[model samples]
Target: MASEELEYAGFWIRVWASVIDTLLLGIVVYPLLTAIYGDAYWEGANFVHGPLDFLISWVLPAVAVVAFWMARQATPGKMAIAARIVDANTGNNPSTGQLLIRYLGYFVSCIPLGLGIFWVAFDSRKQGWHDKMAGTVVVRKKSGTTRPVEFNA
Candidate 1:
């Protein structure tokens, strides 16, 4: 059991985490993309411009996110807010397979007018569809304390 009190991170905090992550990623990725493909990259008709775009626009973020999850159990944004991802049932770190599924599940959560993501607001466990799909949850110690979340409790 967790030695201290924990809270399910609510919608607003998660949104802020996502915002921070997106902005940070954009800061790094957009310039590189423009440098590699030129400003026309934005107005290009193709979803991806070329090989460099595929590597930059697609592969880089995937690798970075999974790497972060493996190393920290959270992205920089989640880390900023002292949140972590864990197995929904175990309250322990999720396996690599689960983390990958969780990443892919973001597409599913965002597909249906983002109803899946918004589901977090109503779910008793405070899970988005991605979380439910991957059997994972985002959790944190409430306030400034370090009461790590323990799911088995």
Candidate 2:
């Protein structure tokens, strides 16, 4: 396990990253949803209004996000801010299982009035509940410092 103090990405940066990702997903998802549901797209706030809605809203994003995390160790949003996700203890790329758990953990983070996500703002390591659940962390490179791919935790 890595054994050193590292700079963890805090809540605001992560929130902004999430916004960017959400917007990007929206660009593709909204049009597809509109086409599938037509005028009834916004008829009600139901989550699973139809099969396509379930596929488009939930399945697709989960797949895309996990794929990005596996392939790049970060999503486009995380990359934009020079942040990457890694095992919390190892400071290396998280396992596929961990990535999946992290994705599901998002729901947990959001369900309870977003307290889990907000935890990042106060945690010493800047970890949210999803990060804690998946044993992962978001970190960025220190200015003028070049370290190995695996951070020193």
Candidate 1's residue-wise lDDT over 1-153, tens digit each?
372567788787899999999999999899999998888888889987889889988899999999999999999999999888889887888999999999999999999999999998887767999899899989887764333445654
Model 2 agreement with the true structure over 1-153: per-residue lDDT tens digits: 233334677788888998999999999999999988886877878879988899999899989999999999889999899888989877878999999999889889989999999999998788899999999989876542323233444
The runs of at least 3 residues in candidate 2 whose Cα sits more than 4 Å from the true structure, single-residue gaps closed, are 1-6, 143-153
Clashing pairs in 2: none
Best by TM-score: 1
Give the alpha-carbon lDDT of every model.
0.86, 0.84
Worst 10 residues of 2 by lDDT: 144-153
The TM-score values for the models, in the order shown, are: 0.91, 0.87
Clashing pairs in 1: none
